[model samples]
Target: MHRLLAGFVSANLFFSAATAKAADLSLDAAPMFNWTGLYVGVQGGYQWSKDRSTEFFTPTGAATGFSQDFQPDGGFGGVHVGYNYQFDWLVLGIEGDADFGRASDGFTCCGGIFTFDARKNWEASIRGRIGVTPTDRLLLYVTGGAAFTDLKYSWNSIEPLFPGVNANVFKTGWTVGGGGEVAVTDRVTARLEYRYSDFGTTRFEWIDGSYEQHPRFHTARTGVSLKF
Candidate 1:
């Protein structure tokens, strides 16, 4: 009985020493960034857009030989909110944001008698984000989901040959993009991103004739975020 007790005590001492050594090694390991929190941010960038519209139309709504194309370029800025979960080397999250863009131009097409003005206004999107962390402080990700925006289309008579008409509509579309983010501090991060949005095609009609337009845009943005 005495020998058995002595052996048991020796075994426990060895076990305790092993546990302490393992704990010390764990404490000495490299620290990892915690990305499991809610974040809010603001971003700004440039946007370029292109749209095709019918310039000349047949009296019976048939296609004509002439067409119209317009391209506008400007800057945009906005704010966003998101939540992220990091597991191993992967980070997944969802983010939503909205921006106001300064992109518009006026032109006369078809017969040069009618002038048209197109303005790109407010835009918003909700997207799923998936990324990998090559390092703790940096993330590379791609995002895709639904997008929203509106266009202000206006038409006027430069020579009084046609009546002035205008159309305003809200549009929904699809967007896809990618970005890179870096943690700047314990509670701050910043990112650079690029996205493309397609608003599809639709036709607008007036009292005398009709026209069709297909609109899309590309945006490159930079943002700063605060984590909570």
Candidate 2:
């Protein structure tokens, strides 16, 4: 009876030790989440722009002593597509997006004798992204690249009986921004971002005088993407 009791105790100890070791290994060898794939998404938000400064010149390239400032704000919607490759906690990617909306400003100058207006029709960008994953499901990133947009400007003077004149032009420059993304599921992610774009100075020529405008703006948006 003593021998039987000793054998039973020894077997129980051996099984318990083996089970504890297995559990430790299971905890230590868990897999990590990876962010590597192609994705497509849609986004929408509001944008506000500042002209920085404006210059009016005659057809002969001489200054026209007419100066004013304008600010335009509105809502926009867009779509984006991109691909990302991951290295442990770091992620690198490339993305492109296009947005369309109405952002315009109208006001009168010269004692209400002259009416001037500006409108932003659409904008797009191709950017590179660098991000870090602080946790398995959260990512923080910054992006920058080339940007393009269309702006239309109109003006008329009632005192001089001048007809309305419009100049539609495209501007190109650079944009930079940052945002955070959350992995809602294995194949879907949601993100919120903000960007500032500067389209330098563009010359819009009219019959009598030309206008030089510096287009710059701030944008805030949210989007959901599906990974493949």
Candidate 3:
């Protein structure tokens, strides 16, 4: 009976020591993640655009049957500002960015009879952002909202069946896209996102003719941000 009591006491003491060791090695005392802050960043990426145009002139104009489409690819870089609020594993944010570069393409439409040139100097957007953190260091998000850009162009006909026209104007559109981001450091985060912008159609009067453009395009960009 004395031997049995001693064995029970020894077993209890061993278990207590093991539990204490485990407690020291556990992550329960680690710091909780906090991603509530304002951030500013720079981004650079590639964009491919395909824009559609049609005649806005009256039945009396020379362009009785006129249409044009152009596809262009280029690079863009810009800056962005945003705010983020983390709720458990989901994060909500709002951000705005402006990108400037060159996107131009010259093509012949009307069965290669009409020559058209498309040019865009810059673009900007403001969007609502939402994402989920699969891990403490990563975030997957989808963003969308308002987009603005300019469409500048001049198209002339070699045969004069369609008169020459040039226009430079800024238009508003809707954009939507998504991407994944990772926290590279305590105050820095990096991301890659894709967006599709549609400006619908706009009316313009060039020379003696009225015309309209229905434009849309896609963009993919990578950005790095600093949180405050």
Choose the strongest candidate by lDDT.
2
Write down the worst ten-residue block by lDDT for model 3. Answer: 56-65
lDDT of each: 0.87, 0.88, 0.85
Cα error, residue 7 of model 2, in Å, equals 12
lDDT per residue for candidate 2 within 33-119, as digits (tens), equals 578999999999999987733556675677777667889889999999999999989999999999999889877876898788888
Off by over 4 Å in 1: 1-30, 55-59, 110-112
lDDT of 2 at 99: 94
Clashing pairs in 2: none
lDDT of 3 by residue, 1-228 (tens): 999999999999999999998897786776555667899999999988777667755657556476767687789999999999999999999999999998888777658776777778788999999999988889999999999999887868877556787888889999999999999888899999999998888767755666666777789999999999
Give per-model TM-scores: 0.83, 0.84, 0.80
Ordered by lDDT, highest first, the candidates read: 2, 1, 3
Best by TM-score: 2
User: Which parts of model 3 are misplaced by more than 4 Å?
Assistant: 1-30, 59-63, 109-114, 156-165
